[model samples]
Target: MNKVLLIIQREYLTRVRKRSFIVMIFVVPLLIFAMGAIIALVAKDSDKLSSEQVVNVVDESNIFSDKFHDVKNIKFKPVKASLEQLQVAAKTNESLLILSIPADYDKKNVVKVFSKKKPSLLITDEIGRQMNDIAVNNSMLQHHIDPVIVKSIKSNIAVNAVELTDTGAKDANVGPNMAVGIACAILIYISLFIYGAQVMRGVIEEKTSRIIEVIISSVKPFQLMLGKIIGVGLVGLTQFGAWIILSVISTKIAGEAFNSPQGSMMGALAVLQTIPFGYILGCFLFYFLSGYLLYSALFAAVGSAVDSETETQQFMFPITLPLFFTYILSVSVLFRAPDSALAVWLSIIPFTSPVAMMVRIPFGVPGWQLALSMFMMVAGFLFTTWVAARIYRVGVLMYGKKASFKELGKWFFYKE
Candidate 1:
């Protein structure tokens, strides 16, 4: 235990002191902010490009009744001319593009657009939106239903989900919950890969250099392997902790800079106050540790078995596949129907629970489900550590040959 602690201290300090680690701790958040700024600038530029475009709406059935509203910078000019007249008019005037809604538009819902050149997609999208609104209103009128009543009914529907817990009813807004859930899941996914690979690479570096020979003479192969995994895991946690702190500080500074006289901050920083940071950070630390410990065992084994980083690729695929599969499902399926049977199973399954359950957490998971998932993950990592230790004991001494699945299978049966 003392040796493992020493090893952990050495690994954590070694990595934490590196210039690259220091640079990355600050660089990552800056890159994220820069990316958001670039996207916003691009969107603003696109809006400018689509500005002041004239759209001629020629409605034959008078469905819109000349009540067609302008959207963004697009001007809607309802022309009383025939289609042939409009087409002829469009031929001479390059800027004039005609949108012709036929008399049977209610049945067909087809709006023909005539332009001298191909019209911008933005202009067409706005036109389609206006047509859809008009069609909805026309349908409501045809059924003798009041549009105002329909609008009122739409406005009245608000879903505020509250979870009854030991404390009390908790606010469960799906938007913020979904965001937090996905963020936690993604953090675990990234940390697992980043730190797990570090474990593998560390082993590969020592083994290739024959430094493992000296280390194992003093410590058992299992102790060394366990120490390395735990050490690297702590390094990951340190970096992650720094990122969270910096993110909070940056957000607070931004909020203060943009605070209005009404006490609300401008831009997106206003949203920071509403997020349950303590809850998210608590769950994140637990899952991050669980996920890293779980995957790093296999990564350490892969490192010990292989001669170099390049050879570890073939073995890495299987270890990474489950994480990838759960990530895809979390984004597409789990967020929508978190309590579905498939989601429930995935969340409880040891291999995928770290990602799957985090996504389910914000949506409110059962207490038993959370407890069961944690148990399975804890048991899974212990079992993995045992198996990986067996491989590490024999593989660390091996040299000059590429390992295969057949060879790895043999190492499992070798007596300690």
Candidate 2:
């Protein structure tokens, strides 16, 4: 245990003290800020450059004179000309479209649109809406009904969901819930690959240099693997924690500098305050650690069996496949039906629980399910650690020969 602690200390300090790690901690946020600024500038310039699509309207009925309206990127130009003349003129400009409303449009209600280029869906939809509104008003007038009174009666419905928990009712908006859940899943996904790979590489590097032989004289292979995994895990936690704090500070500063009372920053801040960040962040930490440990043990075993990083590809696929598959399902499927049977099974399964459970957290999963997932994840890592330790004891001393599934299986049955 003491030796393992020593190894953990060595691993953690070596990475944290590196110049590259320190530089990235500060530089990444600045780059993100710069990128946002560039995007905002481009959006502002685009507004000036954008021109509205002009549509030539030939309203023969004259009753629909004020029906056509101009919106952000669409303009209606009423013309006193025949369809033939308008069609001929439309050939000159691709952006110009011609709409002909015939005299008998009241009976047939057929409006023909002529254009050199196909008009966008937005322009077509808006024209249809305006024409429909005018037709409805005309019909109401003929029937001696007031269209204004009918319009006033239309109402917009807003539904706010609140979950009734044992403690109390909590706000349950799907939008924020999905956002936080997806975000937590992404963090887990990234950290598992980044830090887990670090552990694998660290083990492989030491083995290649024959450092493991000397270290083995003092510590057991299981202890060494455990130590490396824990050390790298702590480093990941530290780096991620720092990044969160820095990002919050940087965002607040940027918000103050760029936002006025009427600016988007104020609106963003308002939205941010509504999010249940304390719960989200807490769940993120739990999933991140559990997911990392569960995978890192397997990664450690892969590192030990292989002679070099290039030799690791075959072994890595099986280990990473579950994570990749579950992440895709979490995004594509779980978001739609979070409480579905498939989601429940995946969340309970030890191999995928780390990512699957996190994806379900913001959707308000039951307490028993959450507890079961956590328990299974802990058990998963323990089993993997034992298996990895067995492989590590023999594979660390191995050299030159490539490992296979058959050999890895045989190693598991070997006496400790």
Candidate 3:
């Protein structure tokens, strides 16, 4: 145990002291802040930056004669020219579009748009909305019904989601919950690959350089593998913790500098307060460590089987496929249907549970499901570690010959 701890300390200190690691720890947060500031400034001046577009209308029906109004950078003008003439004219005018409404527009409710280039969806949608409103209002007037009454009856309802707990009902912030859930899942996904790859690379480097032979003389293969995985995981935790602190500080500074209205800031704060960040953070740490352990053990096995990084490619895909699949499912399906059968199954499976469960957590996973997922994750890592140790003990000393799946199976079954 003490030997394992010593290996862990050596591995942790060796990488964290490197210049590149230190540089990235401080530089990434600054770069992210700078990019955000630049985007905000550009968005604040987008209207001024955009050129005005002219839409010439040739309405044969004349119903929309006075209804067309200018909005944003788009100007609508009523014109008498034929459709062909405007189409020809539009070729030379890059910012000009022609909207031709047929004589039977009310009956057909179809309008043709021609432009030198394809018109944006925003312009098309706006024009369609206006035309639909005009047709509806005209139809209502002809039937002696008031459009104002109909409009007044259409209410835009806002729903407040409240989750009932055994203790009491608490307000649920759906947007923030989804945002935080997806964010945590993504973070775990990236960390697993990054730190797991680091373990594999470290193992390969030691083996290739003949350093492992000397190190193996002092410690058991399982201890060396476990120590390296845990040490690198601790490094990941340290980097993540630092990034979170830096990001929070940077966000606070930016918020103060931007000087948002107090009411809006308070409203944002209220939304944030309902997100259950403590629970999410706790889950994130658990999943990150367990997932790292699970994948890194496989990574270490792959690394040991090969004498070089290039040889690792054959073994890497099988280990990485589950992580990739889970990430896609978590994004595409889990967010929309956290309680769906597919999501429930994905979250319970040990191979995918780390990412899958993290995504479902913010949406309020059942206590039983969460417990089951955690149990599976723990079991999954332990099982992988045992298998990896079996492979690692033999593979670390192997050289001059490439390894195959069949050979790895042999290695796993070899008795000590």
Q: Which structure among the candidates has the greatest TM-score?
A: 3
Top lDDT prediction, candidate number:
3
Q: Write the per-residue lDDT of candidate 3 for residues 1-416, one digit (tens) a residue.
A: 99999999998999899998898899988887788779988988988987888888899998985788788988889998888988888899878899989888866647788998889887899888888888889899999999999999999998898988898998878888998888889989988989999999999999999999999999999999999999999999989888888987876765576565675555666678777778888989999999999999999999999988888889998888887898998888889999999889989888898888888999988999999989999999999999999999999999878999999999999999
- Expressed as tens digits, the lDDT of each residue in 1-416 for candidate 2 is 79989999999999999998898888877776789889989988864666788888888888775677788877888888788977887789787788888888767648878899887777788888998899899999999999999999989999988877788996666787787788788778878999999999999999999999999999989999999999999998988888889989987886888688888888777667767788878878887898899899999999999989999999999999998999999988898899999999999898888788888888878989988888988899888888888988899999988999999988878887
Model 2 TM-score, all chains together: 0.75
Candidate 2, residue 51: how far the Cα is off, in Å: 7.4
Q: Is candidate 1 or candidate 2 better by TM-score?
A: 1
lDDT of each prediction vs. the true structure?
A: 0.85, 0.87, 0.89
The lDDT, on a scale of 0 to 1, for candidate 3 is 0.89
* Global CA lDDT computed for model 2: 0.87
Cα shift from native, residue 126, model 2 (Å): 8.3
Provide the TM-score for each candidate, comma-separated: 0.79, 0.75, 0.85
After superposition, the stretches of candidate 2 with alpha carbons farther than 4 Å from their true spots are 32-155, 163-173, 251-264
Candidate 1 local accuracy as lDDT?
A: 0.85
